[model samples]
Target: MSKLKVAVIGCGSIAKHRHLPEYAQNKQVEIVAVCDIVEERVNEFATKYDAIAYTSYEELLANQDIDIVSVCTPNYLHASISVAALKAGKHVLCEKPMATSKEEAEEMIREAEAAGKKLMIAHNQRFVPAHQKARELIEKGELGKLYSFRSAFGHGGPERWSVDGKDSWFFRKEEAFIGAMGDLGVHKTDLLRYILGEEFVEVGAFVETSSKKNADVDDSAVCVLKTENGIIGTLAASWSYVAKEDNSTIIYGEKATLRLLDDPINSLVIQYIDGAVVKYELGGIQTNDIGGQSSSQVIDKFVHAIIQNEESPVSGSEGLKSLQVVLSALESNETKRIVTI
Candidate 1:
């Protein structure tokens, strides 16, 4: 079969690090177009990839040969761009925190359904080797009856991470929607749901803008979740961490406790009730960028979905499940009561 022709919209950090590089690596894909509001970024990416560059996404979407589109723009643009791509008959892989609100996410889903195209959200953590292994174990009943789990994701801030740091859209509520909760918390929320194979039923949360600098959005957030299976746990995320720690979950089950940390590499520690401790040192999963390994995995999966005619690892509906957790957390924080998820 011929290679799938793909186009990328929004030549931002994620496009540079994850989607572009991964698509370039995939023998089944040929990136035929790149777009960004910033002409310079689009030009550089298109030049590097040997693809056509456009300043407007509309121009790129007009390419009838493009089989897939990756929307790497900010949180707010996800729905509009994805809907357009789907309507244009191209599969879409959108970045996580799928939309600023549930309504937008629903619209994107509807568009994809109407267009008979795939719409995936980039919740790449689902593809990490350690996380994947843990999920398999849990599904196979290796963890026995699950009890609870805790997870967190945070960094110094997005200033250094983004091309525009403090001035980045991540620091602006209008662009980012919800700060730490949507940025870091949503990933953990999705990870927990994926690993535990349970839906969150309720949430109690505390969101605060503790740091005075860049006070437009939340700096930190902590939430308690109760799963449908009655498993309960805590999730914490922050841009306030002085140093970086990609600390993740500790799932307690009847048979054992499972732990995951992604800093050095993806590592899993499983402790059984009989005092047998098993540690699995799964190295970094292949990603588009080193720091964004999960993003790379997400792109690879999306490409594979296109090639194999299968469902994406993180479909739009699955993305909504994670987003619902974040939304519930926001409501919980505001109302000072447990919010149904």
Candidate 2:
């Protein structure tokens, strides 16, 4: 069996931390090419991964030999790069937020459909062990009719994980689209959707840049969301948690409450109304912890889907829907009214 040749566009923190390393670890994938606008970063990654390097993604995509293209670039470039890769006969595994707008996301999905290629979004939170387990439990009726939920994804800031530190693209609204919401909130939205098996129909949001000096984007944002099945929830995304990262979700049900990624040791816990409590010591969510266990199951699923000729685990359509949630929040914030998805 020949390995799938993979090319990663944008050799920044995410490329180095998740996409490249995970692809390299997958036996079915070969990290054949790496790209970055910066010559130094591209050259360094090429050496590290023992692959060819390119300063331009356009040049990398021209090599018809590449089977997959991973877009780890800024939010604004995700759609264009993914569409281009799909049009060039390459499957795309794009990072989160999918695109700056819903139309761009639709374009990416359309291009992939036209090209007949897999278009997976790197919404890794849905792949976390705890989250996977939570969904399984919920589906099996262990949680017993979920009613409400609250999720939050926050950290010190992007400087700790971004290659450019203070001047990272994450802080620029033009490049990032929406800072904390796009970077962190969307992951929670996707996760909640996956767990509850529902879509957010309405949202009321307050998106702002309360922290992070000189940043042209929101440093924090919170949304009040209502799913199609009458499920209501709150989502908080922020870069203002200077002390520690808070990646937690609490799901309330008629019979029990599921706490995910809430405890340091438990990772997942269920507290029932009848005084029965269950705890599972699952793997923790990725915090980009300065090199401490930061890979996702996304690459494995992406590879398996391609090898098996199946739909991607997080398909382009799924990405588009999740992105619609984020965009709805932005619209809600702008109008100070509940926006419908």
Candidate 3:
């Protein structure tokens, strides 16, 4: 089969670190075009990958040969770019959270359906080996009626990691909509739903701009969720941690408990009430150029889905679910009360 001709809509950190590298590595994809508002970055990527570069995403979307479009733009532009690409008869792989608001997400979904194109979101945590194993265990009923869970994701800040540093959209509420909640929190939101196989029903949250000078967005946020199945959990996401700690999940079930940690390699520990414990080490999950191990897995899955004409594990609808959790959290924080999904 010929390679799927792909175009990237944003040449930011995520595009450089995850999407471009993974697409370059995948034998099934031909990254034919790259687009970014920043001409220099787009040109550099185009030269490195031997692809055409565009200063505007609309120009790239006009290219009839492009089969896939990866929307790696800011949260606010996700819906517009994705809807345009889908309407242009191209499959789309959008980054999470799917959009700045639920209405936007719904519009994108509607457009994709109308165009009869696949719409996948980059909720890569679902592809992590530890997360995959947890899902498997839960599906097998080994956890035995989950009672509750806890998860968190934190890092220093985007200033050090983003190519734009302090000027990155991450620090701007207009472009980012929300800070740590949308950036790091959504991953946990998606991961919890993937592992638990339940949707969040209600949320009560607290968000603050506790650190980061001159930033208008929250640097730290915490939320408690009640799942539709009666499982309750807490998620903490922050940009204040000096060192990264992607620690996640303590699922308490009737017969046993499971713990997941991404650092020091992806490891899962399961303990039973009868004094038996099991440990699984997933080693490295092939994160692209960055430390996003699950991203590599996600790209691989995306390519497979394109080749097989199948549904993505992290579908656009699944991404919307996570975004709904974030929106609910924001509403809860603003209202000082629980918000229903």
Candidate 4:
């Protein structure tokens, strides 16, 4: 069995920290090509990884040897690039906020299905160790009958970590299509869906741009969400956490309250109603503060899915569902009404 050849479509921060390095670590993969509009960035990656460099993604996609495409471009380009890659007979592993619109997300899924290629969205929160452990315990009914939860992912802002700093496309609506909600909020939305095995049915939100100056998009957003099973809670995404990054979730249930990624020493803690407590130092959740972790498990799952012809763990459909929740939150913020998913 020959190694699968991969071409990364964008050489941005995500490509540098997560997709590129993680794919290189996969023994079954070969980093065949890298592309970015910036020649210097692409050339740097190509030199580092021993792959061909291209300033145009289309030209890179034209390479017949590439079996996989990692779409690490901005939010606005996710749908188009993934669709093109699937049409070109390549499996796609796209970054989060898979598309800026619900319609776009559906089209990407449709194209992947038409091409019979796997389409995965990089919602890595579901792959975190503490998150995986929490899901397992929830499935086993340890956190019986989940009632409510609060999940937040906030940091100093993308400018601190993005390759272009303050000039990064993340703060530009034309490229990002959203700010903190799409960048950070979507992760928590997807994780809640995965951990609780439920879908968010309704949302009412307050999305604002109060924190970051001169940015047209929201830097802070707070959403009240209700799941299909009647569980309700708050989801927050902010670029205003000037001191430290807070990527934490607290789940309330009839049996026990699960605290995930909240404590510095213990990644997961279970506090029972009867006063019994349990703690597990699973591992730290990936953060921009540390330039992310070495392995998110997302790349590995995507590789295995393609090799074994199995459905992706974070499939296009799953991505669309999560995108819908965020879209609903945006709509709710504007309409001042609870939006139903």
Return the TM-score for each candidate structure: 0.95, 0.98, 0.96, 0.99
All candidates in order of TM-score, best leading: 4, 2, 3, 1
lDDT of 3 by residue, 190-268 (tens): 9898889889999999999998896899999999999998999899999898755555678989989998873464378
Least lDDT summed over 10 consecutive residues: which range in candidate 2?
286-295
lDDT for residue 77 in candidate 4, whole number 0-100: 95
Could you list the CA RMSD of all candidates, in the order they appear?
2.0, 0.9, 1.8, 0.9
Q: Candidate 3 or 4, higher TM-score?
A: 4
- Better model by lDDT: candidate 1 vs candidate 4: 4
**C-alpha lDDT of residue 277 in model 1:** 85
Q: Rate the local accuracy (lDDT) of all candidates.
A: 0.85, 0.92, 0.87, 0.93
Tell me the tens digit of each residue's lDDT in model 2 across 107-148.
998998899999999998888889999999999998787899
lDDT value for model 3:
0.87
- Candidates 1 and 2: which is better by TM-score? 2
lDDT of 4 by residue, 1-341 (tens): 99999999999988999899999999999999999999999999999999999998888888999999999998899999999999999999999999999889999999998998999999999989899999999999998999999999999999998899998899889999999999999999999999999999999999999988868899999999999989999999999999999999999999999999999999999999999999999989778954566789999999998899998889989999999999999999999999999
Backbone N/Cα/C clashes per model: 2, 0, 1, 0
**Cα lDDT for residue 327, candidate 3:** 93
Best candidate, lDDT: 4
